[model samples]
Target: MSDLASPPLRRIQRIRHELHRRDLEVTRVERLSPHFVAITLHGDSLANFRSDSFDDHVKVFFDDTPGEPARRDYTPRSFNVQRLELTLEFALHGSGAASDWARQAAVGQRLVVAGPRGSMVIPVDYDWHLLIGDATALPAVHRRLEELPPEARVIALLQVDDAADRRLFPEQMQVQWVETTAELQAAVAALTLPEGEGFAWAAGEASAMAAVRPLLVAKGLTKEALKVAAYWKAGAEAFHETLEA
Candidate 1:
């Protein structure tokens, strides 16, 4: 046998939280872009809410649908424990229960949000970071960007419906906005992995993310240093899955 040993993988902590269902009222609403809406919810129930990861998702319940209540997973964009306020950004895709509710969301509207369940806390000390995804991934991408230190090196490849959907991120980070998945794939394929250890994170439509995962691996990212998820799937409701090698 060869005497060489593999390098140690970076440790990613998994944290579980006590599940809580919070009934909150919309305190504010803002049109973030032509395709995004920001809803701020406030209630005493959120006093102990915890989301340790930028990519953590919570279930939003809607009772307006006939028969069974409709629920969808949404990223907890931001939260303030002291104020008992939480903000969620909804991607307006023209349909779906959550989208419809967010489009018509106004002050005083009530909403029930459930657990993030758990969090995968990725360390920030990596030599570099890669963020890839589409419009649906905006909230998580924004959160990660804001959470990273000013000096941390990051490169984000985001696909959006239009130029109008683009949002500003830190100037120090390289942000590439693409209009199609093909372009996103091209961008990923063309990228040169930076020196030293790094982490790659991606989330978006099912098939698109499925396609992007292998490209990152081919670029030399190990399984332990990557996370690719399907935030939604076309024609499927509340679809979310993590693609594993």
Candidate 2:
């Protein structure tokens, strides 16, 4: 008998950043959809800012609250070193300090943002990619799609309240837009993973992500091949966690 070939190793690199608390001013705001707002912030502090991962999160501070500032995690949608600007997308789910602030965010308004702290850089050489989540994951998913080569194979399962919320991607990319978390889970369970080494990434409501994590593993994905995160939780404030098997 001949020895079997080992699967290609997928290495995820982690890099730490020098934490800086930046006082940034809102330079622009665009309503991407009924429930999503894109805000571009600019400041001198961002001159050396680096976010090497699509899913890197920064701490956004809201001082509107009477007590200590309310802090929340937000994904860096995009950044331009030359312009010293960083773009962040806020998902407005009716309520929450961040949501409220984004709902009325205006140019010239100052905000304090701190550490992405570190980045976990996932390689893009995988045979296929699976992205699953709700509107909250849009920034990461969208950024990833943009970063990937046009030839990359990707299937994105996104849950959005309205069709207008969906963003355009490469025509070759398969995007399944669902309206509910239940649909999102069903879509994942029914997914037929492509043959070859693949990576799965998911984020959204905590409970929903908890339910979807095992399905991916059951579909022949090892713990090392997938990353699932709880971007937010129902009835809980400032919640974020990465689920591990």
Candidate 3:
């Protein structure tokens, strides 16, 4: 057979690999903190999943019952795709499909997952950036700060559980940590924004974001200047949607 007419060897291998790689069981679960649960699954099939500098999330599959499908979006904490190992942190909210699953998830349980999908990657070249949100948006906020090159001015307003829930980020970054005891929206609203170029990114509760959206716009930020998402809702199940309105 002519070389051009024959099937490529690499293409053949990829097709074969695709047949075997799909989903795996939950092999391990670790409690990273009181508020977070890091569940690691075998990474053999997901070896190609790559983390971007900004935000990346996956559609986590769950079985709430027979014949009824339930799915929720989750962010990967860390992953070693080669080793088939990855971790996902779940904020224990005591409700929602994801939070409930993480609350009761155990080693040996099975889960179906798909995609790091697309990235909400925001470059740090802005004159200044504001990361405002509650606990749910921590993963995105942390990733953004770490990915930013040193000497870049950035500020984050994070509402977490006391000091224990506060995370350490870049040395040059300024953080305003609010305990979860206070209202999530009010905490972010109280921030004294330093006068400068601001590209704000906020996520977490939807209603709170609804209020804050225009507040930032009124402060001279353009309508498209902010990137906001609601990872979940107060009383809804598996609520995951963009809060751009």
Candidate 4:
């Protein structure tokens, strides 16, 4: 197959392990924005819960319907080790099992979450970090910004539909908030990268992120210094559909 027909290459090989499921309780729910919902879940069952990477995700099962439970994947945004409280943010898009749950999630609701199974665990020692993605990828990007060293230079190139969806980013970090448009690929192409070794991470629409890979490589990032994931596709029902290939 031609390069275009083959799967996109990744910088680091990911590791996986069998993950055990945990039952959780919804302790609180807050609307972070018009398009986002923040749900906090906690329980003693989370005594051994762990997710050490910015992009770690857990499978959430909900009983929105009468049949087999509906399932969705979500990033584990924050975990309070001391309190054993885990927070997960959901993007409220069109009606779906996950979106439906986030819209009406209330305190006392029981939820079952399983596995981050593994983590990528990108090192923070790089000269700089490049973060790019849409709203679906925001929680992970924000997690990176919050976890990285304050001195670490980060360039955020993000795309969101409404202004209300934008969150408060640090002043020191360079951020480019692009209104939802087709020019995102062009914007990434025009970035003036700083000197020294850098790492680039992006997640968004499949084809759009695929176009960013060669550009970062041409701008001095090696294949080992880049990580791009397709969080969703325009016409696909599930995000993992691409992973099956």
Candidate 5:
């Protein structure tokens, strides 16, 4: 476990400090929606793989012919310990190496992925939790829901291109869906949060989420209780493990 003061976003970094490199075989592929695809990976190496944080990201590498491999960061949606299965979801909105690969991914294909390295495990002690992001962040949001206690109260505000992209969660969770980035920002700005100590997590377009950070802080969410990040930026091709503001 480690801690780092990452400027605006003070991070409670918990990293394994070790990397697991594996050649995984694709076992299943499904299109959950027109804009989202889910891929399941299975391999012996997945045994004992630890993904303790809902927001943990693994580095995925793809074949690039004779050159260096193409790499992208993805959240591990679910991991079945008994079956040694790991699932990943991809958003197919942009034209890029990762997006193109996701569009054509199929069973029997091999993929190489490395470390979640470390996880920032958020304690489920808050009176309520708030999740905000675009379609790309649903996997993490869903993971958090699944991991939280049944009595946990959650509020999720998501932005997606279509209503069909909306995700289902525990009945205790209140979900609001919006169609555009601007709508997402407006909704957060005007949010009437539940009472008590609350935590807010936001991930999406860098610029948009950057604008949202201040509002959350001003809205009474302590600096220690807010986790805001830019999942992706417009016109960017490469992916860093952690988003920087």
Candidate 6:
């Protein structure tokens, strides 16, 4: 077994070594869904945006206007260097800074975005794959689903505010949703995994992920097979770190 069962610590090291890894550039933008927008970001400087693995997210900085406190960490939904085009998916919650910015961002508008910073590069040859997330994490999850090998068997748990939040994905992924509000840990714990030697991924709320760790462990999945990140916290305005056990 590898000394580091997961790549998170290594990824953090990569971020520390190079926080401003990619230069920020805003190209074009479009609304993808009622709640999601696909922003086409461009940067001749982004020519070196090297990321071949899935779920690679970046720290995106958005300011209401220039010289203000820029706040946001966004993941590119899809990008291609050959075309010098990168896309970001935004969730319109009428809440966070990023959400509000994305919901109202216009073309010719500029914002600061950064990083692949490095990601959890799971081996492509793993068994079954499981993805769990809410609206905030959909972009990261959707990007991975489309990028994974065509034959991958995936079981995904989606938590949304209501039925309207339910959406579609490109690949053959079985998605189950739990209509929920605040408490998410129990809902996530109730998710059924797909058959096979599966690898699990969960992101979004900290408590939910905290709840997931033990359940996954109980199901006989190794710590390596699971990569859970708490992207935000309840009632917190900024990015909050995950509370580890």
In order, candidate lDDTs are 0.89, 0.90, 0.68, 0.81, 0.82, 0.67
How many collisions per candidate? 0, 0, 4, 0, 1, 0
* lDDT by residue (tens digit), candidate 2, 1-245: 11111244878899999999999999999998888899999999998899999979999999865788999999999999999999999988778789999999999999999989999998998888889999899999999988898899998999997888888888899999999999999998888887778789999999999999999888767777889999999999899999998
C-alpha RMSD for every candidate? 3.3, 3.1, 11.7, 5.1, 5.1, 4.9
| lDDT top scorer | 2
lDDT of 1 by residue, 1-245 (tens): 11121242779999999999999999999999998999999999898899999989999998765778898999999998888899999989768788988889999999999998999999888878889999999999999988888899998999998799899888898989999999999998888777777889999999999999988887767778889999999889979989998
Model 5 lDDT at residue 50: 89
User: Local error of candidate 4 at 3, Å?
Assistant: 23
- Candidate 5 worst ten-residue window by lDDT: 1-10
Model with the higher TM-score, candidate 4 or 5: 5
Predicted candidate 5 versus true structure: per-residue lDDT over 1-245, tens digit per residue: 11222223334556674788988999999999888999999999998688989989898988776688888889999999999999999988868777899899999999998978888878776677889998888988988998889998888999988888787677777888999989998998888777666678888877778888877776766667778877777777553423333
Provide the TM-score for each candidate, comma-separated. 0.95, 0.95, 0.79, 0.89, 0.90, 0.82
- In model 4, which residue pairs have backbone atoms overlapping below 3 Å? none
After superposing candidate 6, which stretches have Cα over 4 Å from the reference?
A: 1-25, 64-68, 181-188, 191-195, 240-245
- Relative to the true structure, candidate 5 reaches a TM of 0.90
Better model by lDDT: candidate 4 vs candidate 6: 4
109-189, model 6: which lDDT tens digit per residue?
A: 776667766665676555567787878788878778777788887777878885665778755777777766334556555
Candidate 3 regions exceeding 4 Å error are 1-21, 51-53, 161-163, 180-196
* Worst 10 contiguous positions by lDDT, candidate 6: 8-17
Segments of candidate 1 deviating more than 4 angstroms: 1-8
